[model samples]
Target: MATTLAQARSVLADAGAFGFPVDVSRRSDPVVGTRDSSRPEPFATLPRESAAIAGEVLAGELRSSTKSDGSGEYEAMQLLRRPVARATAAATLGAIDDDARNEVADAALDWVDALGPVIAAPAPPYRWSRARRQEDAARKSLEGRIEALGDPTPARTATMLAAGTQVPIAAGAWLLVALAERPELQERLAAGEVEPIWVVWEVLRLTPPTWATARVARRSLDLAGVRIPEGGVVVVSPLLLGRLPNLVPGGDGNPHQQLARLEVERWRDPHVRPGAWLPFGLGASACPGRSVGLAQLVALTKWATSASLHLAATPSTDQTRGIFPRPARIAVVRVEGGNT
Candidate 1:
């Protein structure tokens, strides 16, 4: 069934009437949490102090993936992982040092990897099972590193880092893929005529990292003309709703085409708001790290546009662990006129 912007917003707004779609019974699971308390705070607004730090860190990370001579091929998604991970760690755990940031970033990825089989498993594993053991080890390693920070509480830090690190990686990768395929946009960007921030929003609109979020019905009710029994699953797809003409600015062309392809200029209109499509999310469960995520993406976009991007192969989506470009390899033929 097609979901509209109004319906998606309505479903997400009532968090009380709807609950998380993930299994929340397992207290030991590193990924899923049952309570609102587990959701960290103050990250929704990225402080100016941290924004500069994050932007610099993100730019450096992007620069590092280039060849020693300053030009080379890179796995776009793979290249983005570390920088995004480290940037998110820096943004979420401000007290940590560079070395600790590296440590916790690596650990956050491990925890995310270990969570894959855990979620795909027929059921939650035994506490001592291999998946559980790997997940636990990664979680502990991350916790130990972040616990040294002493603020935001170690528990909040861990959750924030995990959620904050993973999604941005996927989003950044998608952004790069879009840029690589559209050379004219890349040229415009290199010429300093484009707003990198708008590129970030457009990318999110076409391919949001968290494409869909779920809610469980608390009690039987009819919603958006569908009847839901108690404990029923009510799904809201940002990807689907994003394609709706009403939410995205059509200008004079077919609005659905705007949904299918990246329109970097669609958001340039002053009257159009940046997030009508529900990329970060809505209501109490909406991601708090959104501001920080956007900052990191903007920084990445700035770095990417200045480089000559040549795709090794057309990148495809790997739905295995959320959406990231499958085999995300790309060649930076040159870094702004530098020879490889």
Candidate 2:
């Protein structure tokens, strides 16, 4: 395990020396989502127009949810389900009809759900097991939806949509939870006292959806002072790195206590650069749709700040599928000026 930030950075930076321990040849084409024999990067950085579309979709979803629900109560994960899925789908499925995009979005959600058991299993399930079959079915369904849109790389597109959707959904929920928990901070953001991006960074620092990632050493090598044999897995935890005093603001208050708190103002200082902890992994394997994800979060933060929201129930941590706020129930106390 990469215990220090430097070690983690080294492990991630040298993608050649370290790789994910997966047999690409054994994986199904739809799940692998490679372009061809060479397996070039299938997911690209989202274009600005696509990012804007994602932001619009997210904002509209939040507004619709708030207006349609009489009680003003929302389960963060469930509420964000369609919005994040559809937002990512709309962004990635270029120039598709609204209905086709929506279908792809729903299919992506189903695929993600189906993937839960496969990912959570301690070891890969049997190929013919119910979980694997269901997952395969869901993936094929998503791929088919993309194919219907005449997308040349339907499998790749479906994989991209699913991969992009899940993380942002959790991140968006944490953003809402953070805002709801600190009304003062929310007010400051709404009043434009603080930049929304800082809040997004803070949420990502504290509760990054992909809190930890693993890389396997392709060859026996020294990592920091430690030596490892071939295929040794090195895990990097962003959650741990985010709390380091050097990476984030913690000197003002007790360093230990302050680092853990959600302090958006901490980012006001121009010197301390954000994302030092690598909320999104670094190097060639870094998240491809990070731009769209950030746009979605910032947009959500803006919409959240416009309204008064309070936690209906305390959120519990769920590490099964990355760290996220489960049962993140919130009550919209009041709607303010307008949506962002």
Candidate 3:
């Protein structure tokens, strides 16, 4: 694995020399050909209008379900799922009618769900296995929906929607969990004493959804002084690189005292770059939805600051599909104007 930030960047930056571990030539999916050519990346800058719409959707959903059980508690994953899906879909399928956008969103979510088991399995299941068959059905359903929306690249669109939807859902949940555990930090955020973006950055650094990524060497090369033969695999871990002292401020001590600790102010230093750890990967293949995803998390943090939320139960890390907070239950104890 590339342990240092410099080494990680070196590997990721050499996109021509390194390629994804998967052998796409053997894949049956024709859409893979268009992935690199997909146009108008979803919410590349997350315009204000789209951001406002997403914020409204999130706020409306959370408000309606805030105290449904009189205990003010709700499952984080379930609570944010549809809203994230819809918001991402709207941003992805720009100018599309609401009905069509919603349909695509739901289909993308179904594809993501069906994809989870297949990804989490210990080994690739047989092509004719139930898991494979179900995943294939989900993919076709999503692709069909995207195609119906009139996207020139339906397969690429389907892939983008599914990828964008799932990661933000997990990232947003983690942001809320972090805020809930730190009332003082929330208060700081509420008072505008802290940057919401900083909080989001810290959470991403600590628990990035795509913690590690692999690259296969296209030819023999020297990486950070280590010789790697052609076809050799190298892993770059953002989670580990985020711990390096040079990359993150206040990470000069022990692991727990460093990036492991959620100190948002550590980013206050002007010279230290926020994303040097490359939480979203690097180079041409870096996450295309980063801006939209970051906007979603920042908006969530802003909303969270206006309300007091507490954890109803201890959430655990789920490694099934990237890292996520499983059973992330939180109680909406109070809103800005009144108790929930």
Candidate 4:
């Protein structure tokens, strides 16, 4: 419930103190919830290979979107879904052909949509409930596709798509939203006066899609002066911690003002680390596709800066779908005589 960064960091570091939210053992009875130990493969250790694959895929998609006619009103979030999904799908699926890779990409988005309601509902739905049923169907479809490609564990593949493809779509949407609003930053980005990586970091700091993550105590433990018995849950919010002035630099004014104001300059100082707020997270379960996701986003920033996209209307937040823009629609047109 608290937003203390150090305590959150401590819990994430100590695997003995806490385990993942769904790491419990499976119950035999149908009345009980299911357990999942299928963690996605981390891409941090495979930088060179991942960068080449995801970068090429992502760049090509962006180029395609800007083709035929660049002047069109588009829903920014909807526009990003396919490209991001394809990039992530390609990166994770290894040497799959283009057609098979596209099939998996569509399935990933469908599966993520099926999961939305289940995660947002107050309580868990029954196995036969609509949300659960839809989730199962989509999960099966995705898994079946992966199985068709000679992959044994489609379940892990589904998990990878859910975390890697879907979440990054939301994050990329937020990045576009930030760019649409911040004309000053956009100008700097357009002129190549500032680093595109900072735009990604600034957007993440402002509105991290996976705002909060949870961990449950394996046994009795105390955190930040609170004593909890066994099986207690602890929630760490990167969104809240990101607003902390102490963690990120460049907040000479009041706390609220500093946080509300986007500070791309925060990372300009070499002494201050970019990940003190843990946007992707820390320790072992800290998103295996983080580096891959960043590479995609960086390519996105490069494309966005080169294009001209204006927010059609003030984008509304859709908290039901894990903090995404409600109608992430925008007007995208080429900045004539500029880099198309």
Error of 2 at 61 (Å): 2.3
- Clashes per model (N, Cα, C within 3 A): 0, 0, 0, 1
Candidate 3 per-residue lDDT over residues 1-340, each given as its tens digit? 9988778888877666776765111133212122343222332444566666665555565555556432467788887888788888877778888788878888888889988878777766667888888888988998888887677788777777888889989988898899889989988988889999999999999989888888877778898889988778899998888888878888564855766788999987777789888988887778777777887787778767767889999999999888999889988766546322
The candidates, ranked best first by lDDT, are 2, 3, 4, 1
Cα lDDT, all candidates: 0.75, 0.81, 0.78, 0.77
Cα-based TM-score, every candidate: 0.89, 0.91, 0.88, 0.91
Q: What would the per-residue lDDT of candidate 4 be over residues 35-94, giving only the tens digit for each residue?
A: 333332443443557756886798788678655656677787788888898999888888
Query: Which tens-of-lDDT digit does each residue in 1-340 have in candidate 2?
Result: 7777788889888766777655221243221222233224635677888889899988887777666432378898998899888889878877778787788889999999988888778877788989889988999998887887788988778778887999998998998888888888877877789999999999999899999888777678898878987768889999989988887876566888888888888888888789989988888778788888998998888777767889999999998788889889988765544552
Off by over 4 Å in 2: 23-42, 68-71
**Alpha-carbon lDDT of model 1:** 0.75
The C-alpha RMSD of each candidate to the native structure, in angstroms, is 3.4, 3.4, 4.0, 3.3
TM-score winner among the candidates?
Answer: 2
- The TM-score between candidate 3 and the true structure equals 0.88
Please give the TM-score that candidate 4 achieves against the real structure. Answer: 0.91
Tens digit per residue, CA lDDT, model 1, 26-142 = 443232323564332343454667767777788887677566765667787678778888888887777667897898889888887777777667778888899889888878877
- Candidate achieving higher lDDT, 2 or 4: 2
Assess the local accuracy of residue 322 in candidate 4 as a C-alpha lDDT between 0 and 100.
61
